[model samples]
Target: MARGEPVTVEPVVGEPAAVADLGGERALLVADVHAGIEVGLRYERGVELDSRADARRERLCDLIRETDADRLVVLGDLAHRIGAPDGDEREELAALIRAVTDRVPMTLVEGNHDAGVAEAFADELDVIGADGGVLDGTVAACHGHTWPAPALLDADVVCTGHEHPQVRLEDAVGGSRVERAWLRGDLDPAAFTEAGTEADLPDDPPELVVFPAFNERSGGTWVNVEGQSFLAPYLPAALPAADAYLLDGTRLGEYRRV
Candidate 1:
């Protein structure tokens, strides 16, 4: 495949990661890593916990090797500090970045918590705006806190994070549990008109893929739970008739109805 041709992005079964064929180079796509999350929990909520930074970094490295990805694209929130990185957070991030970049080139899409990381490690990664950037001139990747770049809206497909989407399920016995999910739908060209983007709406809109967070410690909105709301401002409204799927790839028609 070449630039402008249809790109391939397939979710890795049972994991919140995807393999994207960036023309001929494969890239691993992950989002909402929230590294050093224990630090944030300790600071913001007065909760103390052990750092899973090592496990998180190793998981990513394993994915890169297993997928044979030529590059790695972090959709957003690679760090947990909402403002700036320092202390244990900075150290963990440094190690994580080094580990991934050592294996393959990496791109970090700016999420709400990533500004400081971008500024601090500008030399180690290809840090793009939170609005997102096109990969291999085909696949579009964004953080989803805001609308994607207009050009990204015109790609073969658009993928994002920030929702950390999960669905609550109930058994016949009334036991319930939450599972992270993938939300996908057709892009509504009319949706971006309000965001003030001048994207040339394609005659046939591309698929809009909402990825789940890679960090299990990151609790997210229970999409199917009543009174729970979507985090992305443009979601639910922008993605009409969106469907939710489990990490195992079981499709539960219509995320709203799941």
Candidate 2:
């Protein structure tokens, strides 16, 4: 694929979600869709978090249909719990996948949260890998959790959604704050090593592109926190330095490093 211009970030109203348009044929890139996260949060954490998931699904379907995209690429976290797949959750997710697949081709990339559940529904959907899958020419997609292999970076644009990256803002008095900021930056290999659960990352970080999480309950983490590291190794260097775009429903803002 011919090298396209840099990624364009756009936000959707209602749920305050953002998406990247890759300037490709019939493709809408997305990531970090923890399908059953709400159920799990309620079950385990006892947090009665709520969002219009069904409505979001409908809007997403509408977006796919209206955009006339032939494919929907999910970067990762297709499911919530690791290695746990309840029948009800599986059925609900399967139905959602079927609905979207009915409108456009759906591609699922595995993330840390996706282990047994994602594979279980693979037969009903197209499952891509972290190594990368060629979308058209050089355009490739993967879950940015693991270090992207060399081949992935060769693509014109690589899309992944594992960080669930967000920017935190505070008032002058440091009382009021706002989240839901869109994050866009170059891919760095170093940020992946900082995860507390995992130590060490690949020697070279690929040209990274991180996407915000789709699940509302999966709160976004402040990228600059002391020990709260991101799955993408190069995030620290890429962010607040490289091009970063924050979106609020078609409104885009350039982020200045704090």
Candidate 3:
């Protein structure tokens, strides 16, 4: 693929989602869909709630249809928990993955929470490295928990998802709400060069796009607030002037930690 060729990245409307239209390599990118989170809520937080696995599966299927994507790239955390999946969790995850894969190809970039996932989904899908994977051989993606492999930094654009970025909005009545938001900015090429990979960066450096958690129940970082720590390793160095946008393509401008 030509490095100079422009690819279109847009947010999927009527939902908290995004997609990168790479011509024949079109893909829908979503992050941090912590399947079986309801299990955690019940067991850990002691909250009684119905399982949302069916709802999540339907939401994902609908988004896939809307985007008309040939492939689905999950940024990471395809399942909850740090260890192996239990019977209930495995069933929910398997069902969701089966539902999507039955329609189109799926790739799960390993996330911090994705341990034992490779074995779990071995027959259904190929679980890629935590370091990241290249989409359409152009855009590089990682789950944002660790330093990405040097190879992943050489793509036209870098995408990551571990942050689950969100912005805080307060109304006149002193009530505040946090909504999922997409974070977009350019990376500094000099940083890559300084790391002794000067030739790896393109003449025009790639932009960085951080995806919000796809699971609605997953709590997110208050990105626009003061003293909020960023979780991604490359984030502090990239110093992304993160512009927050809703899924409807409404631009909220640059959101900086206060």
Which is the leading candidate under lDDT? 1
Candidate 3 stretches greater than 4 Å from native = 1-3, 189-203
Q: How much lDDT does each candidate structure score?
A: 0.87, 0.61, 0.80
Sorted by TM-score (best first), the order is 1, 3, 2
191-224 in candidate 1: lDDT tens per residue?
7444665557777777789999999999998988
The estimated TM-scores of all candidates read 0.95, 0.77, 0.91
Query: Candidate 2 or 3, higher TM-score?
Result: 3
Better model by lDDT: candidate 2 vs candidate 3? 3
Candidate order by decreasing lDDT: 1, 3, 2
Output the better candidate (1/2) by TM-score.
1
Model 2 CA deviation exceeding 4 Å by range:
1-24, 188-207, 224-227, 237-240, 249-258
Q: 1-258, model 2: which lDDT tens digit per residue?
A: 234554444444433343444445556666777777777778788887664457657866887766566677777777777776776567657767888888877777777777775567757777766555656545667676665555554554456677776666666887855355455545544443334534333343334455667666677766544566666654555454443444443323444442
Give stretches of model 1 more than 4 Å off: 1-6, 193-196
**Model 1, CA-based lDDT:** 0.87
Cα lDDT tens digits for candidate 3, 1-258: 236676556678756667886547678888999999888677777988789899999999988898888888888899987788887888899899999999988889999988998887788776779888777666888898887776765677888899988889889999998888888887765552335543555566677888889888888888888878888866656744657887677788987742
